[model samples]
Target: MRLLLATAAAAALFAAPALAQDPGHDMPMPAQPQPTSDMAGMSGMRSMMSAALGDYAINREASGTSWQPDASPHAGLHLMQGPWMVMVHATIDGVYDWQQGPRGGDKAFVSGMLMAMAKREVGDRGTVQLRAMLSPEPFMGKSGFPELLQTGETANGVTPLVDRQHPHDLFMELSGAYAYRLARQDSLFVYAGLPGEPAFGPPAFMHRLSIMDSPEAPITHHWLDSTHISMGVVTAGYIHRNWKLEVSRFRGREPDQHRFDIEAPKLDSTAARISWNPSANWALQASWADQKSPEQLEPDENIRRWSASAIYTVPFGHGGYWSTTAAWGRRTSAHGDLDGYALESAVRPNLDWTIFARAERVASDELALPPGAHGPAVTVGKVSVGAVRDFSLTPHWSFGVGGLYAINFVPGALRASYGRSEPQGAMGFVRFKLD
Candidate 1:
């Protein structure tokens, strides 16, 4: 907690002089030169946005070292101060959630996330980025909201949490990256964070365009991107043209029940990944990791995880796009191998309306078992669809209201435990975002 506060203080101090120069305005200025011919031809506002490593547009960089389609739209407040480019993205949701069945529960709670990032070019050939992401989920309480078939992490210090989504820590990420351009289309970089993401999964669900507006966490989270909030991470990678290869060493244990304090850091896990953006509309990746002990209650279990995913996006009407993602993941341990698959899509037909849907199936072993017990995995599936209507409140902010309905499928063996073969769940939420 102290470290997180100190980092934020230092960043404010670094940007103080620039902010003081123009006390009357809170908008971006063209504080740096355009590095490429393509960027030079863009409009002034577009050109002033930050240039990522290797002179790529910053919009391409997603959660951690992940990449998304270049044409994907970004919603944030962007500004340039002195030699630094700053971007802030945030969303808050007041939600009423209900899951129906014998094992289901209901809750009304609030959840939100805020991310701030700053970057600067170093002597023309290098770029440096510093990022901090915080969440108010801790205020949602430790047990978090109820979501049928969701698993992983613990709600208390001892027992594992099943069929419930755990709240994220107050400090979700505090990380830094440095990239040195080796050629026009190539770069080498290193990233390290006290609490950061490793290069082992697709962009975290919250960061993906396909499900960004939805209020529920995916059931396949553990199988796919559960490591998004590792305690310690160090990664090195090389990027060439549209392809990137990276490797990381990070802490494998999931965060403890405490959601407001920092945990000790360790680097006991290893992972490697390869990513490719074939064009402006496509992004793909494959990754593998040897996790030490990903579950706090199951300390002796070591699992090998593999994941592959592809995302596609295309522009349609003015300021609108359709995005889709197909992903598959698996984990192998002494108990057995469990697999998960997901398909998610979202469409913004216009600026005022956003629609999204997701389908997921996972082999879940924790659902029917007690907190500290292990059993054979059972197959469970969920399908959800929803929409949101947005109203612009100001130039830099927007308010939205949305609702979603989901149907969950469980196998015959577990039907009795869940009270039905198919359980239903739904959520209605009002949201506010910094645009």
Candidate 2:
């Protein structure tokens, strides 16, 4: 208990200085007029606003255009100016699993995110941005699944159960960048910072909303959430008036492991991507990534690794869009493989209503057991579907509600260790914006 208290005190001491710094402090600047361009319609309006807002207040300045969507008032205050704008955001999520033991105990997962972002405009050219996020890893309620424990084992064996109630996965990051105009209609932008991993596709449904998070075992299977600080660089180029190319490198530790023991050499990541917009209403994108061990255990060996992915998006008719992504990866030297896919579509027949649906699948290879153990390799599959409704309660505020159903499949021993088979579950949330 004394140790725990000491640790808490140390963390508080470290964070106190940062909290003392005023979050709303900003440099004063003279007002400026918006820019102008030859392009007609929405494009011209955006160009004008981009010039007027300069770099620091683009997102908000752009909101002034009549055709553009209103800015999110809930996004919080801007902390900086110039070609860069800094802001903060907070979010909360709740999850419930209907599949429990014969006793029919339901489970609950709750999480939160506190993040700061910096966006820089590369002058009149383009923009760059970085973001840092802090949050608790995923955690489940005590009344959750009990069958996963052997007769003698207890919930204490599951770290998230205890860590969640307190605070365990304390995480933070800093990153963001912008683009520069290279030609009449072309621009180049680069960004580096802590971000999500590009893993499983649509069917896997492993990464619900957390873009940089992993959707594997301890995370998806055991219900433990993990976050890591990663440094990354991304370069994007616009060409042919309709195509965009992107490539990036991320260097950082892996997620969900003991920090001190983590091996830094093994922490390297790379990604390449391309996107094409045939028309104002139609666009497509594809990307790939190579990720090494985030935690370098044996600087020489025992490093986790993997590479894989494919994605595409298409729009049909007015306000209707469809997207699909697939990926396959293997952990070097480990008996782990990941294969998954996802498909989704959304349509807005009118201004008041929107409809969307998604389906996904994920599978993993078996891990080689240690000496004397009797168990087959591990494999898992999951699926989920849901819909969201956005209602304009007021000119400045919009509300939304959503629900989802998820299913989990696992072999015996793996199921026993990770509570592999979770029945269907659901979630809901509300959002507000200021502008």
Candidate 3:
């Protein structure tokens, strides 16, 4: 029944609005000739909503390539009418894995997403956009998918998540924004979402091409981009050419165990981010958030978190690119403060081979323990690499089988019971995508 309701909601969302926006209406416009200056007045809003601008309105790459390195790689379906454009972005990632660790489990599951965005001219110098995103994760079981030492959120009702990535809720975002042009290169906007992300962290790791091939969440997910699923958010921003500044009010709490339900929205937290693209090949961002009780088990705590990252992408042979990212994150709380750092890269040297690697140093408190003892804060380092060869069966379908290997540098306190500082994991997968 839950699945049914979710499916209905998605269908309704997609169908209803699209019909209302159909350009088939018989209404005719009564127009008078406008001066060239007046036509030029709306350039700012047009630049933001124009298809010629590639699909990203917010981040412009370093050298101004149509491909925005910071934006997620996507296969889109689009429609352009008079002064409006509508689009859909979707993907799914799944894998089979085997791993050795205190908090690791082997399994097969997919992480999938469907997002839609629609924009239209609001007035002479104004534009409005609506965005909706959804995911289905409940069928994967209660304990959640595997990772060496990821921890955050809750699962199976009231149980704190430890060393595993929790399932995303059915609805990830349902938001809207209004933008007004201030000048040829300037725009101001206000955004609100029931369940939306704030201006913090690198675009969710899952969306970064540098590590898109990796199925596991980064071990340092909580320290950086956990708020990508915040239940309520409102953001205000200013965009001028290749730079943007944004501040947000959002619910700090991560989603609870019920992946099928939309939790209540709370505006108990705040965050700010500033990003710039010096050239089309590079994008840099820095952000901070003051959050309250983001984790259920750590209810009394408040977290002041900071993150920064540099992302670079250079287009190459056959719809491929070399993408890389380096990021740092820190979280300060009453009990202690910890830091996390990550570097990763992905390259498709040729049409047939896709390769990627990542290294991370994470601070963990949830798994810092001995057989019969509790230990101090500990930091662990993890590294992984993988490759896939494409065998195309059709233009939109292909078969891919890949392998990955990961090793961990366990802290001394955990070395005793965990046996050795090194625990290993590997995975194999078959993938599908739109061309």
Best by TM-score: 1
Q: Candidate 1: where is the Cα deviation over 4 Å?
A: 1-51
The residue-level lDDT of candidate 1 at 325 comes to 93
Q: What lDDT score is found at residue 103 in candidate 3? A: 53
Task: Put down candidate 1 lDDT per residue, 1-435, tens digits, no spaces.
Answer: 344344444433343222111121222222333334554434333334544555565657899889888777765555554556566678999999999987789999988788887776777688888888899899988899999999889888787778899998888898999999899889999998879999997999999999989989999999989888999999999999889999999999989988898789999999999999988789999999999998877789999999999999876765677999999999999889999999999998988999999999999777765643667788999999999999988655689999999999999988887889999999999999875
Q: TM-score, each model?
A: 0.90, 0.54, 0.82
Instruction: Pick the winner on TM-score between candidates 2 and 3.
Output: 3
Model 2 scores a C-alpha lDDT of: 0.35
Model 2 clash count equals: 30
Work out how many backbone clashes candidate 3 has: 7
Tell me the TM-score of model 3.
0.82
Q: Which 10 residues in a row give candidate 2 its minimum summed lDDT?
A: 61-70
Question: Model 1, residue 90: what's the lDDT?
Answer: 81
Sort by lDDT, top down from the best: 1, 3, 2
lDDT of each residue in 1-435, candidate 3, tens digit only: 233234434433342221111121111111112225665435433433352222343323211111234332333444333344555555566678777855556899877676666666776677776777777566676667877666777676566666577777778777777878787668887878878788888877766778876776788788877787788898888877778788999999888887777788889999998887777677888999999888776678889999999888776544566889899999888767889999999987765678999999977667754211224678888899999877766433456667788887887777765567898888787765433
Q: Which candidate gets the maximum lDDT versus the true structure?
A: 1
Deviation in Å, model 1, residue 134 alpha carbon: 0.4
lDDT by residue for model 2 (95-197), tens: 3434333322444554555555554444556655445455444244222332221111112323322101222233434444455666655655554444432
Q: Give each model's whole-structure lDDT.
A: 0.83, 0.35, 0.68
